[model samples]
Target: MKVYKGIGVSPGIAIGKVYVYSHKYVNARPEKISSVKAELKKFEAALKTSKRQIKKLSAKISRHLKKEDSKIIAIQMHFLEDEVFVEKVTRAINGGKSAVESVREVLQEYEEMLLKSEDEYFKDRSLDIKDVGYRIISNILGIKNELEFIDKDVILVANDLTPSDTALLDKSKVLGIVTDSGGLTSHTAILARALGIPAIIGLKDFSLNVREGDEVIIDSENATVILNPDDTTKAYYLGKKQEYEDRKKEILALKDIKAITRDGVSVTIDANIGAPEEVTKAIEYGAEGIGLFRTEFLYINRFELPSEEEQFEAYSYVVKAMKGKPVVIRTFDIGGDKDFPYLGLKKESNPYLGMRGLRFSLANIPMFITQLKAILRASAYGPVSILFPMVSDVKEVIKSKDILQQVKDELIQERRDFDKDVKIGIMIEVPSTALTVENFIGIADFFSIGTNDLTQYTLAVDRSNENVADYYIPLHPSVIKLIGMVQEVAKKNGKKLSLCGELAAFKEGIPVLLKQGIRVYSMSPASIPEVKKYIREITLEGKNIPDGFHQGEVDGGL
Candidate 1:
C-alpha cells in the first residue's frame, strides 16, 4: 500500500515485478603484476573487446533506429580511442598494477575529474565515461553487465540511466522505467517516451526500498508508483488498467479522422517531436503539422557540434517525410538540461532564466547562421517554418529575423534554392512576452505558447523538480490569463497561434484553451488520438468552462 510519487515522462500503466538494476561498477582489487607488458597487453585486448561489443550493440540499435539515432553508441567508441585515457591506464599498469586494477583506477580518476567540474557538459560526459568504463571492466572480468541480465518482463528501476544504457533497452522485456534520479527532460525520459514505455522519474530514494520480484504498479497518468499494493487496491488498478487500454484502442481507431468538434469547429492537431525517428509516430497519429520540432536533439548526446549539412539533412528528412505538412523547426533551445561542451558557454547558477533559446542563438551568430541556413534549405522540400524558443523581447524576434535575412542572402549568393517566404515565429513562454504580445505581433509571423516554461517562469517553479511537481499546476489562473492575452492579440492581428506544450493536450485544459481562441495545438504524438477524441465530444458552440475557470479559478479541476 506504500505510494511513491514521481513525474511521468511517458504515459501508460504497468503492473509487474520490480527488477532493480544495480549501477555498481566492477571492483578490481589492487594486485601487483610482474610482467608490465603482459598487463598492458591484457588491457589492450579488453579495450578491443569493449569496442567490438559497442559496435555490436550499435548494429542492433541500427536495425530499429536510424544511423544518426544510433550514433549515441559512438560515444563509447570515441572514449575507447582516446589516447590520453589509454596512456593513463598504461602508466598505471607499468607502475606494478594489474590490468583490471589500472583500468579501474584510471577510470575513477577521470570520473572524479568530470564530476568536480562546474560545467554541466563535463558532468554529463561523466556518465558516458562510466558507461564505457563499465563495458571495459566487464570485458576484462568476463562477466555479464546489468543490461544483459534483463531476461523477463519487469519494471526496470535504477539510480539513473545513461544514453548508451537507454539505447540498448529491449522494449518488449522492459515494461516500464522508474529511476531515482531523472527529470522530465532527461535523456532517459526522452528515450522512454520515444520507445513508448511507461516511465516515472525523480522518485528520490524510491529505488533503494524496492527489492527484486516486488509487486509494482505504475500509474503514469497520475505519476504514481505503488509498491506491494493490497489485494483490493491491486484489483482496482487492474480494472483501471484494462479500462485505460480499452479506451486507448477506441480512441486510436479514430486516428485518421479529422479533429473537429461536434459543433463543426476544426482545429489543427500537431505533434512536438524531439527527433526524426518520432516523425513516423507523429504521422501515424494523424498530426496535421509539426508544431514544435525540438532541434536541440541534434546537438546533445554527441561529442561535437552537428555540422550544417547534418542539420540540413535531418531537417530535410522530416520536411520531405511530411510530404507538405507544415513543420515548425525550433532553433536550438540549448541551456538548462541540454548544454553542449563545444559551445563553450559558461555555466550559470540559474540556467532557466539565463542565456537560453533565442538568447543563446543571438550570442553565437555563426551557430545561429548555420541552423537558420539549414532550416531555410529544408524549406525547399516542403512547407517549413523557423521557430525561436524562449523569447521574452520583441527585439529578439527582430534580431532573429534580421539574421535569417542574412542567411537567405548568403543562400541567394550561393545559388541555393530555399523558400523565400518561409515564416518566422517566436515562442511566447515568458510572462513578459505574453503581457506584451501586441508588441511582438508586428514583428513575428506567428506565435506558439510553450506552456511548460510559461507555467514554470510565471509561477516561479521549476517543472522538472519532483519536490514541487504538486505545485506545478498548468491550469493555474495566471497561466490561463496569459494564454488568453496572447490568443486575443494573435487573433486580432490575424496571425496563426498555437499551443505546443503539455497543456495543449490536457483533457480538462483543452476547453479552456478553445475558449481563449487558440485554434492550433501541439503535444506528444501518443496524446493526439485521445485529445482528438476528447475534442470530438466537446460542442463548444457558445459554451464556457465552469464560472470559476472563467473568473480566475486556482487549483480545482477545470
Candidate 2:
C-alpha cells in the first residue's frame, strides 16, 4: 500500500475505488474573421446558450440548495450579460477576431488585470472570472462543461478543482474528494465542507501517484489516503471505517439529548456554517444553534456590495431556519489576506495586520451600516447575535456598536422592525483581547474565541501557509493557556464563552478545551457527531473531564 498525506479540511472516511479526474480545455488561438457580422452573431448565440445553460444549471442546483445560496449562479449568469464584458467581446470581434478568440482575449485581459494583485483573495477572484470566461467560451465552442468520467461511488482524484468545477459536481456519485492543491481556506475546501464530503487537499503528487480503479482508503481524520491497499491494510481501514460509522450512530443517538455531562451541566453545542444550506445539516446533526454564520459567502467574488435586502434575505433564511435558536452571525471578516475587489480596497503588503474585519468595516462606514441594518432586520425573525471579528480593543467594539445604533436609529425613523436588544459579541482571538477580556465585559454580550486566527496572531504563524503549517498547532500549550485565560474572564463576568474554530472541531483538542473550563464547542456540521461522541466518552468515564462531568452509570452501549 502507498500512502499520501494531505490537509484534512473536511472530516469523514471513505473506502472506494479511485476515479481520477482530468480537465480537457481548448485554448482559443486568435483567429481573424472575414465577417464581423457573422462573428458578432456567433458571439450573441453563445451568450444566449450560456445563459440558457446557466439558468438550467441554476434550477438544478436550486433543487439541492436554497435560493440564497443559489444566488451565486444567478450572479454568474448576470456577469455573462454584463454590458462591459459583452462590449469588450463585441469590439474585439469587430476588429476581425472570431467570437471564441474575442472572448478568450477580453476575458484573459480582464482576469490578468486582477491577477496582478499580491493578495490571495483577489487572485482567487481572477480564477472565478476565468471560470465565467471559460463557461461562455466553452459554450461557444461546444465543449463539454461537466466532468466527463465520473462513475458512481468513486473517490475523485484530481490535480485541483476550480469553483466552477466544484459547482458542477455530481453529489450522489462522487463519494469522496482528493485534490493535489488547495489549502484549508481555499474555495474548494469551503465547497467540500458545505457538501459534507470526505475531502483531503494539498496532496501535491496524489493524482500523479494514483491510477483509476485503485482501491483507496480516505481516512480524512488523519489526512491520509492509502492507495492500492493489500488485504491486511484494507482490513485495517475497513475496521476504522466501521468504527467511525458506529461512533456516528452512537452520537446521533445523543443528538436529541442536550449537550451536557452526566452531571447535568449544559454546554451549547453549535455548528459553524458558511452557507444557508448547511443550516439543515447542522440541525440534523443536533446543533443547538449556529455558532458562526460566515457572512462572507454573500459578499465575495462580486463587483458590487450586497444590498441591504439581499443581506437581510440571506441572514433571515438562517435565522428563520434555526426556528428560534440563537444564531450568531459574523460580520464581514474579509481582508487579512482576503479581498473584495468591488470595494476598491487597495493592495497592501501585509494585509493580515492591515484594514480587515472591524477596521475595514469601520473605514467603509456605509457598507458597515448596510450590513448592520440588515442584520438588525433579520434579528426580528428570531434570536440573533451579531459578532465582530479581529477586534483588538474596546474602541473597535464601541465604534461598531455605535454604528449599529445609528442603523437602528435610521430603522426607527423609517418605522422598520428590528430586534432592539440583539446580543453583541466580539471574537476574543487576539492576545491583547484575551488578556483584556474584562474591559469588554459590559460592552459585549458574549465572547467566542476564534482559535484559528488566535493561534495565527498569537504565534505569528500563517496557518494557511503549507510550508509552515505544522507550526500552526491548535493544541499548542500556549494556545490552550490563552483560551484558559479567556474562559476565566468570561466565567468571572457571567458571560457565555464559546469556541468556534478548527480547535473546537478537533477530537483530541476537545478534551483539552473541556479541561480548560471551555464548554461550548462549535464546529463544522460533520464534526458534531464525533466531537460529541468523544465528549460523551470522556464524561462517561469520569476520566480527563473536569469535576462533576460524570454523574451516572457508564455504558458500553454502542
**Candidate 2: stretches off by over 4 Å:** 16-18, 25-38, 66-69, 118-122, 145-153, 162-172, 183-197, 209-215, 540-558
Give Cα-based local distance difference scores for all models. 0.81, 0.78
List model 1 lDDT by residue over 1-558, tens digit each. Answer: 699988777778899999888756544453467699988888899999988888887777666564555666787788799999899999988888888887778888878976776544456567767788777777776767677667899899998887767877889999999999765545676578667788898798998999999999998878899999999999999998897778777877988888787788898899887788779878998888899999987876676888999999999999999999999999999886566766778979988889988898899999999999999999999999989998988788888888899999999999999999999898898999999989987788999998988998899997656568688989999999999988888888999999977688676788878878888998877778777777777778546333211111011110
Top-scoring candidate (TM-score): 1
Candidate 2 local lDDT, 1-558, one digit each (tens):
888898776667888988887655554453567689988887898889878877877776666554455555765776788899999899988887888888888888877986797665556556556667777777766778557446478898988776667767777877789999775555576667657678898899889988889888888877898888899988887897787777667666767666666555566789887777779888988888999998876766456888999899889999999999989999988787677667778878888888888888899899888899999999989999999998998989988888888899999999989899999999887899988888998899999999988888889998667688778888888889999988988898899889988777665676678768888878877667555555655663445554322111100000
Model 1 clash tally, residue pairs: 0
Tell me the deviation in Å of residue 107 in model 2: 2.7
- Worst lDDT run of 10 residues, candidate 1, spans 549-558
Query: For every model shown, what is its TM-score relative to the native structure?
Result: 0.90, 0.86
